[model samples]
Target: MTQLDTAPARLSPAEPSVAEPPAASAVARLTTASPLGRIVVEGDGSAITRLEIERAGALSTDGLPDAPDDLTRRAVDQLGEYFSGSRHDIDVPVRLTGTPFQRAIWEGLRAIPFGATRSYGELGRDTGRATAGRAVGGAVGANPVPLIVPCHRVLASDQRITGYSAGDGVPTKVWLLDHEGIAHR
Candidate 1:
């Protein structure tokens, strides 16, 4: 399998995170159809902040802007390429907002290679929190960018599908893992 893109640069605590950008900053959103479903991407004109997959639900603009900025457009294009099997990674800048440990776990998810997977325990260990499997699971579930961050690459210790928070949940994750040819029960 081709090497995947690593996680984008993380903002320091001192910097404004995506979840809480400057009050005057505009939040841009773009929704595009994909094989998985309708994917919604939101950014602050500079970097992506959130991505949501729609399945069995209506797409909502929620009064946000629809103009796709350079960064958001690039992210959507990369996602299209990935689903088409021409791209193995998405190399776009992302602004992640979360606790330090959650950010660490998200970074660890990015380290997992394409067509590969790591157990919750293994990922926790890799992130220097060997005894924090449950915490790691929470962090993974809270991942905002999902596929861009490769949160689907994590699994239970026995290689069983646990759960997914995006799209159709476990089925979505199963589809993603199968797309990458990662084995799961």
Candidate 2:
């Protein structure tokens, strides 16, 4: 809701080179962060398809205009509040797709309260896969909804604020933590 730019992005080597990546049946809108995009996708007319994190190649690919829909508009507004420290939780329906194990990991990630975080090991334990921290990391990385699902709230077992992949890098993780008024312990 802060920064808005709808310019087309040049493809990068890291991006999928498929001539067609499938038409995005969704629309993406910008958030406060530069590489962040909040998208609302639908499958059945009121049912949401996916609320996802899109870095780049999103706006044009999703065929989005500068503005958002009523639901997307609300999402943008609430996210703005979250980033500005006026909000802590999001109340919206989101549909996600993943393997059963990955879904379990993501579910555990959702249980981590706001302004709080868990280590990979802790998440693995919570999910009843005590020694599956690496699996948890894989699921965390595969999370379709990052901020909405709060994957940024997950950290390494040592409690160090590193290894975050979203945004430019770990500084973005620090910012999210700082915004939530949580300090490293």
Candidate 3:
């Protein structure tokens, strides 16, 4: 199993208001090559905010910092370890911004053990929305941090690859699943 920070997955209603808004200069970014493809990671100094896998076109890093901040550098290193198969889980602080339902689904995704797969219905049920498989899938696709959050671990009820939004789509998912030794069609 991948180790994860024990921070509460759900953000309290007052939490957002408690912290001051980050300045424009607070955003930090880095792009690196991985086994899947080129990846762009953005952070707000303290926590990761976004991670994107480049597909046909390179993901824009406009206006972001030319050098990675300490956090981003660490994330990149962890990603390298993951790709090399030395790290099963990435333990980084992530600030996920999304609807309550989406956050719930993301947390559920994180709970899936390394090399294990979960159906969309199973994920929905785990997130307390058992009948919202479609909604669960939507939230999964919207996940900004794919590998770190392990969205590739989700599959259809029949344990078949449904689709993937990051990198080369289903092929990217296949690579990740195969790396983790997951069984899927």
Q: Which candidate is the best by lDDT?
A: 3
Model 3 misplaced regions, further than 4 Å: 1-25, 62-65
Q: For model 2, how does the per-residue alpha-carbon lDDT over 46-111 read when each residue is reduced to its tens digit?
A: 222344444443432255444345655555566677766677765544444666677666666666
Residue 78 lDDT (model 2): 63
Q: Model 2 reaches what TM-score against the true structure? A: 0.69
RMSD of 3: 5.2
Model 3 lDDT tens row, 28-88: 8899999877898887877777899988766767445556899889889999999999988
Global CA lDDT computed for model 1? 0.79
Query: What are the TM-scores, per candidate, against the unseen true structure?
Result: 0.85, 0.69, 0.86
Candidate 1 residue lDDT tens string, 80-168: 99999998878777777777778778777777778988899997887688999889999999998888888999999889999999898
Q: Which segments of candidate 2 are over 4 A away from where they belong?
A: 1-67
- After aligning candidate 2 to the native by TM-score, how far in Å is the CA of 120 from where it should be? 0.8
Sort order, lDDT high to low:
3, 1, 2
**Which window of ten consecutive residues has the lowest lDDT sum in model 1?**
1-10
Give the higher-lDDT candidate: 1 or 3. 3
Order of all candidates by TM-score, from best down to worst?
A: 3, 1, 2
In candidate 1, how many Å is residue 16 off? 14
